[model samples]
Target: MNARGFTEEQEEFAAAVRQFAAKECGTREQRAVLTDDNREQHHDSIYAKIAASGYLGVSIPEEYGGSGGGILEQVILFEELWRGMVPVHGAGTSHTVAGVYKRYASEQQKKDVLGAICAGEVMSISISEPGAGSDAAAISCKAVRDGDVYRINGQKTWCSDAQFASKILLVARTGRGHRPHDGLTMFEIPTSTPGLDIRPIRTMGGGAEVNDLFFTDVEVPVTAVVGEEGGAWRQVMAGLNGERIVCAAQGLGMAQRSFDDLLGYLREREQFGAPIGSFQAVRHRVADLAIEIEASRALTYDTARRVAANEGAPEELVRATSMAKVKVTETAKRVALEGVQLMGGYGYTLEFDMERHLRLAIPATIYAGTNEIQRDIISSTFGLRPGRS
Candidate 1:
């Protein structure tokens, strides 16, 4: 850990978050409900408690009714939140998007979204269009201005939590031609606006949490513009740095929890009168997992430092962030796989948490830019010669 990077105050914040996760987050049964399944039991009180605990808006500025904490505090909070498997504030997607708005949004825009975000009332971010998944610059959604309102027409898929989100942070084209990177813009459009429709897309793990949103002439006020009219590509690109960092943090937390579980299992399970931890392969696996996790943690925490310092996270850090996400997620997946393999039939059963971890880990490699995409990014950043070319 970077000792100088963490002050006494940050240490105390991390401790409190860990304690809260231990106490308030769901147990085995509750986790099954809060995580894998989509039960409509809106535990608003749980989020409220998180807010009252001064953690809901850890990274939002104090002027916006937050704790005025930095990215490190947020990393700590998320590490604790996901480590305990608690459903954190703003339904996942919104919290990440809100963090973007907090940093880049105009003063007024920040005030509009930050408070609702802290309260967990809104949840949305729609970068994935029907034809533009990894090719974010190829988005075809359009926002046409008329008087004081902009009429939106498009379809967004794989939008997490759009069904219940109060607002949708939409990106649409405001210009023309094949310059995929230019003339795009973003808007904070309320989900309840007329002509807006949301349908639940059943996912393997999260159940009603991800949705497909259809907009037909959805209207948003002029003030909804997040940045310059035709400057969304830059704005969206800037926000991705923070998004990758947060994703890395979440993956790290999951990896840590899986490692802890495996450690405990190895220490207790005996095979032929010797603990499993005594086996050479098991001992080596544990040691390797710990080392990989620590390396991922170092990269994630360093990215957070760059974000807080307002020093634009380097492309290398972006690559490192993706690398950490892929590495940590892969580590968790491997741990879960070996966990089941070692535990035999017990791993396949829902009575254990390893299966759920497996489900979650598979998606981490696919979302926030797939692991394949991350590899391409790293190669391009280093200007490595292409074999075919």
Candidate 2:
């Protein structure tokens, strides 16, 4: 009955997730306590709870200790979690890492890494460096191969959950090639590896969820390379489509939460002896947001289905997923800001969760890829190049 046409099983799954969220981590006060002290321990405990419920592997394969589901299932899982005001930083990145492993990792690597991820062990990816954020191909992290091992030496920025991660999916330059992206390679390295330094980056939202990672002579076995040694460009690009879809799902969930909170406030807060929702201006704005949210949801679901149907078609998926990312994230940012505005001074304070929602939504537009990059991807799909157009 929902806009996305969820099947009976999907509906039941979503309901189960909602029930878990309500019973296990409900209320702003409860979640605040969980996030306030010993963040790494709290995050581990929360992830363990989620893993114990068998929800962590919704999109993973059964052979790898997953639930044998597809991308749409993952989108549903993330959307429901965000709607429940759950912090999805670990879960989202973990899923992306799992997806990459499933596709490009060696058989042994898949068995080890994917199973650990499904069991709630966090594994972060290091792609963005000081010199490269959106331009992943420009990564300067060097991994010099020496007989049976590779010595990694470089720095990575914006590596979320690096402090608590057991391993990191690292991208580095193995050798100089014909193109900027030609020399790249991927590896799975343990966080405890020697010469790997992790430093937390505090945000305005009062959380240190991201970090800067410095790798100096961090050695890994030759078998650690993912996919082809010099073919990481295709692997990275392929993974981005899935990442975008997940980001879109996060945006959709946050937007839905903001809309719900705004509507609740409008219905409860009275002005001139009537609910503020009775005001035509307020009603119209809510209506507009609702329309945009529905549109974003539709696009996101459609793109997920497309990705599921076309597994290896990276070029085709790029356009749809980029559009989904742009629409859903922009909608989330807009909805969160408006929710704060609608609630007046109460929304600005930490007492109300609206401000927190805004903090989370603003970053979605930047991470995964900026909205501007998404627009460019969409245009490129239509044969429009930067100079030619």
Candidate 3:
């Protein structure tokens, strides 16, 4: 293994991905042009190029025309992509969909969807609704069974990539179960469905990466149900391992990039006729950030390895992944903020990548099951319930 603990082949793959990003969207000007002034984080052309390189679905199997790598390879790809600041927004959701399809989708659906995804198509999962963010099971989006299809009608907010996604893995309530997580089912609906309306939600990031999807009598065939009629909760729960790992990997790469930029600035930026980094106070603060970044990496990779080793250990993975998600994302936010503070006036300007990094990092803690929710998951693993039992 290399110093970072990756095998020779993995290291070579990482280097190749880094070079790809450097050539595609490495510089600020190049990224600006590709992303249209930071407005399109998931630029179509750039994503198509990444697909052409066979890296977008690196975690998928070779039978699906993917790179035939595993979760670890996906982690490496995410780190290299974000470290080089490649603005591809579709990788995380694509891999998550790939995993879900592998386990639950029908044979025909798998053959079609997996091949499409590996061929550069984008897909998104809609679990959060207007009233359900942390309480995902609270989704009220209703899908009623008809003769040959399910007529869906509800509003789903914070649906990332819905505006551009080819298919949406939708979670809708079908009936009431003994518990909250029951009576739910997943549907694979095409974006072109007549009654499905997608409204973009613009954030400070200005990428329109997320959207509010409204389904008005949207009809999809019975075959659209992913795994079982009322087994959607199990399907979603089973995919959490890779989902949380994806978040942690993303934060790891972003934190490293922010720290690198800050250190470079400190070394060259002069104050009191000497480099600002030479000051004890500045040095100490930078040292703390460096430590935090390293700690985040260790936690992320360790949890990843453990999850791989104990593939089916759901309970252990729940605790480990929740902790990793919280730490990595929180640390990413802190590191980017610190970079901004260290750079002072220059950091906030659009000319620097720090501002963009901050934009990306700020939401890391909110999405993929918010950091607060993650903490609750971690604590629950210890037999400690947050609210009164």
- The best candidate in terms of lDDT: 3
Query: Each model's TM-score?
Result: 0.91, 0.96, 0.97
Local distance difference test, each candidate: 0.75, 0.87, 0.89
Show model 1 residue runs off by greater than 4 Å: 1-5, 33-43, 89-91, 310-313, 385-389
Model 2: per-residue lDDT, tens digit, 1-389?
56558888999999999887787668876687677721321256777888988899888899989999999999999998888876546888888888889889999999999899889899898889988998887899999999999999999999988888899999899888778788999998899999999999988656888899999899999999989998888887778889999999989999999999889999999989999899998999999999999999999998998998995456678988999999999999999999998889888887777888888889899888899989988898888988844
List, residue by residue over 226-304, the lDDT tens digit for candidate 3: 9998999999989898899989999999999999998988999998899999999889999999899899988888888
State which candidate, 1 or 2, has the greater TM-score.
2
When sorted by lDDT, best at the front, the candidate numbers are: 3, 2, 1
Q: What TM-score, to 2 decimals, does candidate 2 have? A: 0.96
* Candidate 1, run of 10 with poorest lDDT: 34-43
Clashing pairs in 1: none
Better of 2 and 3 by lDDT: 3
lDDT of model 2 at position 3: 50
Each candidate's number of clashing pairs is 0, 0, 0
Ranking according to TM-score, highest score first: 3, 2, 1
Residue 177 lDDT (model 1): 47
- The list of candidate 2 runs beyond 4 A from truth reads 1-3, 37-42, 311-314
